[model samples]
Target: MKHYPVGVFCDFDGTISKSDLIASIAYEFAGQAGRDLVRRIQRRELSVREGVEAIFRAIPSARLPEITSYTEQLTVVREGFDQLVSGCIQRGWLFAVVSGGLDIFVHPVVQAYRSEIEVFCNHLDASGEYLSIEWDVTCDDLCDGGCGLCKPTVLRRFKPDNDVQVVIGDGVTDLKAAKEADYVFARDSLLRVCREQGIACTPFESLAEVIPTLEQEVSL
Candidate 1:
């Protein structure tokens, strides 16, 4: 059997948690009008970028930090994620978080598992109680999809010459990276995209389901 260096990249929002933290924050801070806008974007009736901008615009000028604090309180890490991350680190695997979500939300989660993972995400700018987004889309120039952070580009950059690359995600934005990875653990929108696009992927409900499969792959 061959032993290859392995790198694991995961999406933060719906993948690692039961809900989308940023979306929850938007709902709380931006109120009903903002929630309506989010629905439109999710339905593809509006561009995601435009929808996000609208949400931020609707967010009040006094609840930004409060919303941030609320997010920290509401966010829950997925079951068994800590064990999966620990297992990977124990085996000397390189783990990274590649998320389109804001850094404010991603930071705390990554910090919880700090010694084992690194995070790359978009930044947020908040003044008083209003917020603006700083998108990291430069990686998209290398690919056709106008992704927020261009997950595939991040994979290509950090991909090891001697090991297989693995990506775990659950949305359309994750599809590009899923295609680029040697192994893709997909669910939700990403799984649907893979099926429609005829991309081979392993569907998983959680990281717990992925750990054993990865262990077998690495061992072999």
Candidate 2:
């Protein structure tokens, strides 16, 4: 058994939640045009920031609140999330959500987790049903990684003294952080990226799969 100092940073949308809440909102609220833009972004034909801005711009203002409310009602936690989170807390592991998704969509999940986790995500500005994003311009301009919220930089700032960093995620935006982390648990796009890039990572289908390994590491 081996013990290592640990700090955990997790991606929110698809990693902790069963599906990508922000994407669901985009397709539902932004309609066809917005979905098309997102597809382009996913294919790398458009930058994430540009694509997100364009999609939001195409959506009618009245749909924002509806989307927000609908997302709060519809988002589902990934199976075994609460157990994993509770286990990490009990082990005294520092936990944080490092998401490129917007705060409006991520908030409900955070509330569900209560004071158990801290979040770093993009903020959305809404007046009634209209919505706009408040980009973390100060952080973005300094880091310049093209993420809606730069997860790696946030993790660095949040745990400057941490000796062992673990990043868990399921998307392309997670690549940078995976590179920086001491250990990584990857799935979906992030897993593919790790494979292609030859980055060492443990692959898992869900957070449930991650917990046992984490418990073992902490116990050691």
Task: Give the best candidate by lDDT.
Answer: 1
Tens-digit per-residue lDDT, 1-220, candidate 1:
2233788889988888768876787677778887887787667677556677678767665766787788788888887688778877887777778888887778877786776576788887776456777777545566865466678888887765428788999887687788898889998988998999998889888688776998776442
> Model 1: runs farther than 4 Å from truth?
1-4, 43-47, 160-162, 217-220
List candidate 2 segments past 4 Å from native. 1-4, 112-114, 128-130, 136-144, 215-220
lDDT of each candidate versus the true structure: 0.77, 0.75
The clash numbers for all candidates, in the given order, read 0, 0
Instruction: Write down the lDDT that model 2 would get.
Output: 0.75
Cα error of candidate 2 at position 193, Å: 1.4
Model 1's TM-score against the true structure: 0.85
